[model samples]
Target: MSPQPVLLPRRHWLAGSGAALAAAALARTGPAAAAGETPAPGAAGATKPLPAYAAWKDPSSLIVHSSNTIETRRSAFGTGVITPFGQLYVRNNLPAPDASILAERDAWQISIEGVKNPRQLTLGELKRMGIETTAMVLQCSGNGRSYFPDKPGGTPWQVGAAGCVLWSGVPVRWVVDALGGVDPGMAYLTGTGGEKLPDGIDPKSVIVERSVPASAMADAMLAWEMNGVPIPLAHGGPLRLVVPGYTGVNSVKYVKRLAFTARESDARIMTHGYRLSPPGGKGDPSQPSVQEMSVKSWINGPGTDGTRLKAADVQIHGVAFGGMHAVAKVEVSLDAGKTWQLARLAGPDLGRFAWRQFVFAARLPAGQFTLASRATDAVGNVQPEQRMENAGGYNNTSWADHAVKVSVA
Candidate 1:
């Protein structure tokens, strides 16, 4: 993660460059893939609102997909170091805990069991272990989920179902180490959250339990704060497990129970949801679940589609990130990939899991043009020109992904 600047109050950061604010997210929609009753307490009318986001985002500009999820646009690389708490994207499998309960996180208990030394820790106890900060990108497993050719299944996410945040928490390793080390036989760290389904829905089926590989526990965090402030209910306040580099699903929210086990959790979420299909094949239940994200990048601006092409020189910038490696560099294509130019990467390396910001500049004579971008990670993975189509549109990293057009005056 990048070095954190001096901490400031929420209003200060909100009014400033938005670097110090804490956050809260989603995509657009069709027939509404998400089911179950509305989760937000005091939800206005038929639509559930994320109050934390309502504090910052212009409601008029948001794309409400389901009762809960919302999406943000790209137009950044020109703004804050961390996505403001109010502007961070949100996605929830279950309804959030009421504000009254979240306001008293210290009263909530996290049941940590199944390890050699099973125990319980309140939110206050976890916070007393000292503070560390990490700035990493947190993205929904289906951040790029847009129904192109397939029938829309879930939230219609664009690029906005993702955000970079500065999290404050205690390393999960510390907690595990305090418990006398992990058993070599343990293979998974399964977690369950507080969001439960409305009455009548089989509790077992709708539970948002997920189990991540135990290996992630090494760098994982039990975070309670965002951008240095107490996290809001909308952003998984009280506590959330954050696993960097992996998709957002690994970072479970409203964590109430966690268990170390010898195998993956059998919870429907882990057993049936978010699995990746064989290349070019529809999602097969027998296939393994997805973990690291594929390398990807896209142009953020120049026309309304991307910014309007101007007669004068235009500056272009966007974000690039995927999986474990930091972005090495981004390449820009103007003539439909017939040619390419390297764009300058900005700033020093943040964290390996943090997204790399990039920029390019040029003057184009009046005409209509197509602009596209691709990124290569330090690990040698290059954003492909075409991504294999997935039934769920989980990782939509295709060559034409985010390609934009503008007519120059």
Candidate 2:
């Protein structure tokens, strides 16, 4: 995947650029077809394979939006709370660095500033300071953008652009303390990616640097591992910064510079990108940065592929999570949003930052039905009925748009 900016509308970006090839590939191989199941004869572009860089991923489990922006298939979720690395989504803001950098992962170094004793520390040294594991939702800011009526620019991702995964690394707090802590006035924790930049273009125009509230450091980490294994290059290997509960972008990949700053970074990505604005509005410095995700849930089973089911007991199940809070309960609706029933929360509670798998047992006769799930966090943040209209379609926690229709024979 090559580095590209998100400046054009979805149609223009997908149809006007080579990325169209990737989208075309997804169309020819629907979820079933990609999974090697029986498919209609002569599906368009069905013979194509995932980009060479991402060949390690299971094409059957993901929908390729572009070489750099692959998404998990809805059916590939498989009712599991911890998404396997093979099935996780990939959304890169810049092309990944050569994998050769990972030959000696422990030697990877990151510069830490705004501390009393600022210095560059290698991954090996940071790991020696302290290490912890955290389970959180890694969701793209535009996860449900396709549900937007205006169809914003960027990948028209669905719920599949998110997953709950475990991250292991040295807590940012530990690193700071080891380096004598941050300066008194630091207000933001900023991270800069290590991807190479275009030769003639100003670095600020394409660099991926984001700054989150300094308070987030309590839950942040400079992670070297994902799902218990050393992170893969496509998913930010060698080293990455993890900011739990925030949008995936905040967790900078190939992180090289991490600092406690007095102000947020002035990079274009921070000033003109990822901001929340009114529908059809242009991103500006006045807008808020897309950060913590909102509570969201979507039905994943009784397959939305319109498969006919025998009239009997059916298990309607899916996943739900409160962005930064623990989910208090999840309610399911069988007939769209008209009525709701409390669904059983299944599986061990991974953590507040992680999603919970929920299951609802329903008895049905031969017919059709719309299924939806609503989640409420411990703080009483209920999943909304409608997604707020926005310029970029960033955070869409709307239940109505994500509801699934099922055919029962």
Candidate number of the best TM-score: 2
The candidate 2 region of ten consecutive residues with least summed lDDT is 1-10
Top lDDT: which candidate number? 2
Q: Which pairs, if any, clash in model 2?
A: none
- In candidate 2, position 332 carries an lDDT of 97
Runs off by more than 4 Å, candidate 1: 1-56, 278-285, 304-307
* Per-candidate total of colliding backbone pairs: 12, 0
How far in Å is the alpha carbon of 228 misplaced in model 2? Answer: 1.0
The sequence of per-residue lDDT tens digits that candidate 1 reaches over residues 68-145 is: 686655542233345655456678877676777775788778988766687899989987765566667888877666
Models 1 onward score TM values of: 0.84, 0.89
lDDT of 2 by residue, 1-409 (tens): 2111112222343355323322332233233412322221122322356676678777777777777887777777776667776678899999888889899999999999999999999999988887666778899999888888787878878777898776778889988988898999999999999998989988999999999999999888888977667888988989999998899999999999998999999999999899998988988889989998889999888755446678899899999988888888999998999999999999767678888999999997888888999999888889999998889889999999999877788
lDDT of each: 0.68, 0.82
Q: List RMSD in Å for every model shown.
A: 7.0, 10.4
Prediction 2 TM-score vs. true: 0.89
For candidate 1, the C-alpha RMSD (Å) to the true structure equals: 7.0
